[model samples]
Target: MAEIMLLLVFCLLIAAAVIFKEDRRVRDELRTQLTQRDAELADARDDARRQTAEAVRLKRLVVESGRSPAERRQLDEEWQRLVASDEVVSRMREAGLSPERLVTSAADVATVQPLLERGVTGEEIAQAVTASQALADAVSAQGSVSTLSPAELVRLAGLGQAAERSGKGEHDWPPIINLSEAAGYSFAVGSADLTPEFAERLRSKIAEEVVKIMGRYDAGVVEVIGHTDEQAMGKRESNLDRDLIPVLSGKTDIGTLSPADNAGLGMARAVSVARLFRTDPRFSNVTVIPLSGGQMVLPGDAVSDGSSARDARERRRIEIRVRRPEQPTQP
Candidate 1:
């Protein structure tokens, strides 16, 4: 009876241990499943939010893309009203054409369409109209209205006129100085060297005149721009080799030296000129700025008279631009 009782107690102890281990394993598995379920729920919510935002963006795009027909019609009407204004008509007149003719004639459509397509806004068109009216008034006052031409139109607009000129068509601004006149200022042969006489004239006469002009205008800054001919750099085997070449080549850097050389020459010339003006006490307040204009602004080339050498001289000259200081406003 004692042995049977001890065996029964041992069996009960082993059974309790097995039941506790099974309960612990089941509890761990349930916790892992709950964690996975929570993660899945969060991921679904995130996906739904992203999908909703994208849908909103697409809907906005669709709404914006499909404008109402009525709105488009309204825009067209506004554009037509703007183009049909008296201001536009006046601009056409200033451009050397009758406004009524421009509107009625089919030939005028070609001209109007191009100006419109060139990114000229309605406001610009209106300003052009005003300018045209002003020019017409000026011409009428001068009693030269009959002499008006497209070249005159460009002059009134403060723009460079086209090359061609026809009687009764247009009048261009007269050349400030012809190439022959400009060339007569100095005789500079090749290689950036100026004759002593030329240098003296530039320093004494031109520089002195510029100083007097600046003093007369009470200008604070005088910009001295240097221009040059379109000549190639380096020695050539023939005169034909004097044509311009690209600044860069894989092997030699002779052309690269051209810019520096040109710039130095320009600076030296400007300094030589400035020295004359600086001698005067009246010009002490003015500042001089030297700049190289490269081969730009071929002023004489506007008239193609087969005088390239003469035109080249006009290109190779100096310009003086004056500016004044901004005055402070008094309260």
Candidate 2:
């Protein structure tokens, strides 16, 4: 009876150990499955969040596209007004600047930021705008404008390339200088004679400015164009065809030569100026060409309406222009 009881206890112990091992294996499998399911659910949630964000962005784009251009512009202006600091808005108003009139381009914001921080005044802003408008007019007349922003110009100042252009019909041209005769640069009524004082001014002031401009643009040519009014030289004898060479060669004085018409007078004056430039060491490597604009172009480069007028001082001027040399095309 004692042996049978002991064997029964041993059998019970073995069965209990086997049952505990099987339960642990089943628990580990269940835990692993639960962990995998949790991982899958997290991934699904992330995907759903991304999709929701994308849908919201697309809906916003669709709404924006549905608005008219003017409405969109108004909204943009309103947004700009709202985002501007209260102090800035007040200062701008005090300075007579309309918030609606402020058109800030993406590139312009960087330029305007510092000005805003430093409290730019109305007068200064107006002056800047006026100067910008003048430049824009000049560029538009040339059929293209510079693509460089203020920041880019500052950076390129070191490279001697403050402005540049690309694409068809676009050009990076130097500014034209229309030197008025009334501004202390006047010549004699009918002669190409340049006074000592006027010559000195040309050499010192005008030449220096032209040299600076040339340094900036690296141009190779200088053109001196002479313009005259509708004043007719009444049947005066012209020795220009015979004496032009001698006058330019310094063999004969310009005073000895006579121009019969306005065209001859304009040509004579241009040649005199070109000679001065050619003799200057600063313009030695640069080609200086003399051109006669004659009396065909009006004060603002307008064509003559065949209306003859005498002693129009405003129409008498010397125009100086600079240009780069043309490159030869490859075969």
Best by TM-score: 2
Q: What is the per-residue lDDT of model 1 for residues 1-331, given as tens digits with 9 covering 90 to 100?
A: 9999999999999999999999999999999999999999999999999999999978866765686878657766886898778677777778888866655887757766788899988689889989989877887787654477867756855522222422111333221212122566553543334456666765666656766555544457767655555554344332112221211111322222223343443443444344444555656677766555545445543423333433355556666666666689999
The residue pairs found clashing in candidate 1 are 91-129, 149-169, 149-170, 150-170, 151-170, 151-171, 152-171
Question: Runs in model 1 with CA error above 4 Å?
Answer: 1-182, 187-193, 235-268, 279-282, 300-311, 326-331
Native-vs-model 2 lDDT? 0.81
TM-score of 1: 0.32
Kindly list the per-residue Cα lDDT of model 2 for residues 204-274, writing each as its tens digit.
88898888878777788899988888877888889989987777666887777688888888888887777
RMSD in Å for all candidates = 28.6, 23.9
The Cα local distance difference test for each model comes to 0.57, 0.81
| Candidate 2 wrongly placed segments (more than 4 Å) | 1-170, 328-331
